[model samples]
Target chain A: MPAVTVRDLTRRFGPFLAVDHVSFDVEQGEIFGFLGSNGAGKSTTIRMLCGLLKPSSGTATVGGIDVGRDPEGVKRRIGYMSQRFSLYELLTVEENITFFGGLYGLDDRTLAERRAFALDMAGLKGRERTLTRDLAGGWRQRLALGCAILHEPRILFLDEPTGGVDPVSRRQFWLLINRLSESGVTVFVTTHYLDEAEHCHRLALMHSGRIAALGTVSELKNVFAKRAVVEVRTASPMEAVRALDDLPSVEKTSLFGTALHVWLRPGQRATEPLRERLDGLGIHAESLEFVQPSLEDVFMDVVERAGGTAA
Target chain B: MRRLLFLIRKEFQELRRNPRMFPVIFVAPVVQLAILGYAATTDVKNVPIVVVDADRSPVSRDLIGKFEGSPYFSVVDVTSNDGDVQREIESRRAWMALTIPPGYGDAIRNRRPVTVQIVADGSDSNSAGVGLAYASSLIAEKAAEIALQRRPPGAPTIGSIEARIRVWFNPQLLSQHFMVPGVLALLLMVITTVLGAMSVVREKELGTLEQLNVTPLKRWELTVGKLLPFGVIGIIDVLLVVAVAVLWFEIPLRGSFPLLFGLSLVYLLCTLGLGLFVSTISQSQQQAMMTAVFFFMFPMIYLSGFIFPIENMPAPIRPFTYLIPLRYYLVIVRGIFLKGVGLEAFWKDALLMLGWGVGVLMLATFRSKKTLG
Candidate 1:
């Protein structure tokens, strides 16, 4: 059975539907990524799965226990780390770890063993007495993750756990996540970083309280984006994009820094015809080549199709 | 149970780390009790009086001397002119002004009732009333003595009633004995309610509460754990303030110590529940503090009959006093402190407080569960 099975799960905040008929499954030991912009119902869905929120309708079963019927049972078997660093800022690192460990009902002997393990996991082995607020942002995030998993839960739900950390720290945190996944722990996480989606074994892209895409990175890039992505580096990429916008062959236009990436309609070539059209518009192009659609391209197309802004 | 112990330990660790908690938990109650204990007195003494004697007779000097001899009245100024007495009263130099209207010894010798015109400043009505009562009683005694001395040895007494005013419980009527205990209750209410509410809402603001919500901890465990440390601190505060009341302020602990301490525990639990209720409704620490003050603490203090007597309150609002936990607490504390009353006298208050404390805790726990969801 899948580690997490959510079928037609829905949550409404008053009249506003925060999670609308959301459905997905996380296979055991796989790193599953839930991707969405802010307020796209990622946190709400994670909350429901973590047994912290009751779904308005449908079913969510974590570790074969019905979350709606037995939320406490699901709670005992999983670990959760939120976007906000929720450790006690005034408490020392060891105190936060011990407190959470005790909450998870770890015995003293087991807790002592895990305390050392958690410290090593967060790269905070010798800094046990340092107050949480005095630690750097990256260290705090890692320590929070360490606290969440101190009980050695079978499944982990991380909701934007590296939201505001530096890129280097984020990379290190992902490496930690990879190690956990390799150790046969199902890792379910949410993020806004499209690049980070590459680290997940599979991903679900959410929009407006609905999942728009669910597949591996390459599968999402292929299935949702059927058109060819052609990058054009021109003297004026904005003018190049404007010139290409009205073309019947060009399906979508997105400006990527100094280069303009244009999605050509299916069966259209990205060779002489596109270049000749741009050159005729007085838009001088430096180079034009067909490139594999980035996950950002897939996300933009998915969001645009869902009536949200592409970029 | 173990999880609760851990959570409570965490709470104390946080409180200990905060330097500001020392003054609020340990020092503030003692200082407040000491200050409000002195200021909240109803017993008035040493009222200044201005006397204008127009007669200058031996009888008039004898009456003025009697007023001077009493501890309640101090003859601050003596003048022959009535205008000086009026000026002394108008300028607030004297609390009361007495004018003898050219009274000759012949009025007393003839056994006629002579009225002495006295004006008392009514700005502070409480002190003014006490001062007037003292002056009237002293004058009545002196007049009665003179009347008896003039009467023949065989004549029957005119006044048939000879009543003795015996003030029981507090014969000396020291307001400190009553007020100091009441101040202890007031200090406990403010500190526990406001501080407890702030601590819970602070966790919400910091997002730590949400983290705990996802854990396996039960709702009651979290609620009781969150408030248990503050409850312990509140008990310590009660001990500290009561020590100051009994030892420092010299307010005797008349009744059973265990009864007072036990009732105080029940009262503190109710206040902590009130704080939790305030926090459950508020979204921030600042909002919680404000609600704890204006909504919980102020109404509880006023309706609890801490400063104002419940019987003296308006009839329509009198029934609401039964709903205030501090109302029962004040009765219990005052009964134990001054009246030296045992459990039989205040068992009803203890029962009501017990019911109110449990009801409030259950309601707060229900609301907190909803908020966590």
Candidate 2:
């Protein structure tokens, strides 16, 4: 059976529909990413799946237990962590581990074994005596992850778990997550970081309380398979975008950092026309090259297509 | 139950690491007891009095001597000028002024009735009222003595009625004895209620509460674990403040020790439940503290008969005092400490307290369950 399954899950806060008719499923041991901008219902959906919140309608099951019917059973079978890395700051690393282990009702022998495993996994063996508040953000984040998994559940839900960590620590944290997924632990994660979302086996992009797109990275990039995306870099990106926007072959134009990404119509080539247009407008084109569509480009296109403002 | 232990242990560990909590738990109670115990007294003693003896006679001097000799009144000034009496009272140098009129000695020799004026500073109403009563009783005693002496030997003596009044529980009417026990109840309420609310709200602020909600721990387990530690702390504070009251302030503990402790536990249920209820409504520790103090603690202190007697409170507001848990606790603690009364004397109050305790706890539990869900 799939580790998690949701069908038409909906959550409403009074008049605001936070998660609207969301449906998805995650196979066991797969890394499923939920990506969205702020206030896009990613966290709300994750909360519902973890049984922390009751859905306003529809059904969800985690580890074969219906979340709305037996939330306690679901809780016992899954581990959850959040962006805040909610470890007790005043407690020492070892004390936090022991406390979480005891909270999971682990036997003393199992607690001891799990405690050692958590310490080793967090690379906190020598620093167990340090208070959690004294640790840097990276260590604290890892410690929080370790505490969440002390019961050795098969499914883990992480909500923007690496929000504020340094790049090096974020990479290290992802390594641990990948290792967990390889050990037959299903990982369900939500993040706004497009670069990190690349690590998921499959991803669902949410927008305005609804899933805008769901697929593998290459499959998502296939929206541009028949068309070409030309990068235009110049002194004035806005002027270049305006000049390229008037061309008959160009479907749409978007700014990507200092460059402009110009989408061409299917079966149409605009490289020569774009250079001639920029030269005719007297706008210097430093570099104009066709490039592969990045996830960020796909995100913008999908959100714009969904008739909502892209965050 | 085992999960509850872990949560409680975690709470204590956090408290131990907090440097600010030490003073609040240990030092603050002692300091408050020392300061408020002495400052909160209503016993009137050494009430300074200015005497204006316009009679300038031996009889007026004798009456002045009577006032000088009383422990309750101190003769601050004795002058023939009547104006000095008002000045002394207005300046707050004396709480009372006694003015004896001219011919007071001749009138007394001839057995003629005369009036003497007594002016008192009523700004401090408690001391002034007590001082006036003392002066009136002293003059009455002197008048009785003079009438007895002037009566001819075996001349038809008139029988006079006398009242033999004895104050029970507190023989000397020391306000400290009454106030110290109430302070114990007040301290327990303040500490347990405020700290309990802050502890839970702190978790909410830190986002740890949301994390815990996802765990397999039951709701009752969470509530019990969160409040039981504060309850234990409340008991310890009861022991500490009671020791200070009995040993340091010399207030008697006339009832059973176990009864006081057990009753304190019941009172703690109400306070801790209030804390839990406050936590449910507050989003941060500051909000929780404000709600506990301004909304709960202040009202309870004012209406609980801790400082003011319930009998003297406005009738419409008296019923509201029934809602304050500290009200019943003050009665119970004072009964145990002063009256040496057992449950028989205050079983009704104990039952009321139990009702309030259970009702509040159930309300708080229901609120917290809904909030968590």
TM-score of 1: 0.96
- TM-score (chain A only) of candidate 2: 0.99
DockQ of 2: 0.70
The fraction of reference A/B contacts recovered in model 2 reads 0.80
Q: RMSD in angstroms, all models?
A: 1.9, 1.4
User: For candidate 1, lDDT tens digit of each residue in A224-280?
Assistant: 356788999988887887788888888889987678898888888756777888879
Chain B, per-candidate TM-score: 0.96, 0.97
- Where does model 2 exceed 4 Å of error? B153-157, B370-373
lDDT of 2 by residue, B1-373 (tens): 8999999999999989999988999888988998889999898888999998989998998888899899999999999998888789888888899989998999999999988888889898888899999999989888888899999998987788978789999999999998889888888888889887887788889988888888888777878897788888887898899999999999999999899999999999999989888987898899999999999999999999887899999999999998988999999999999999999989989999999988877777676642234
Off by over 4 Å in 1: A224-226, B84-86, B104-106, B152-160, B370-373
Show the colliding residue pairs in model 1.
Answer: none
Q: Which candidate has the highest DockQ of all?
A: 2
* Candidate 1 chain A least-lDDT 10 residues: A220-229
- The superposed Cα distance between candidate 2 and the true structure at residue A187, in angstroms, equals 0.8
Of the candidates shown, which would achieve the greatest lDDT relative to the real structure?
2
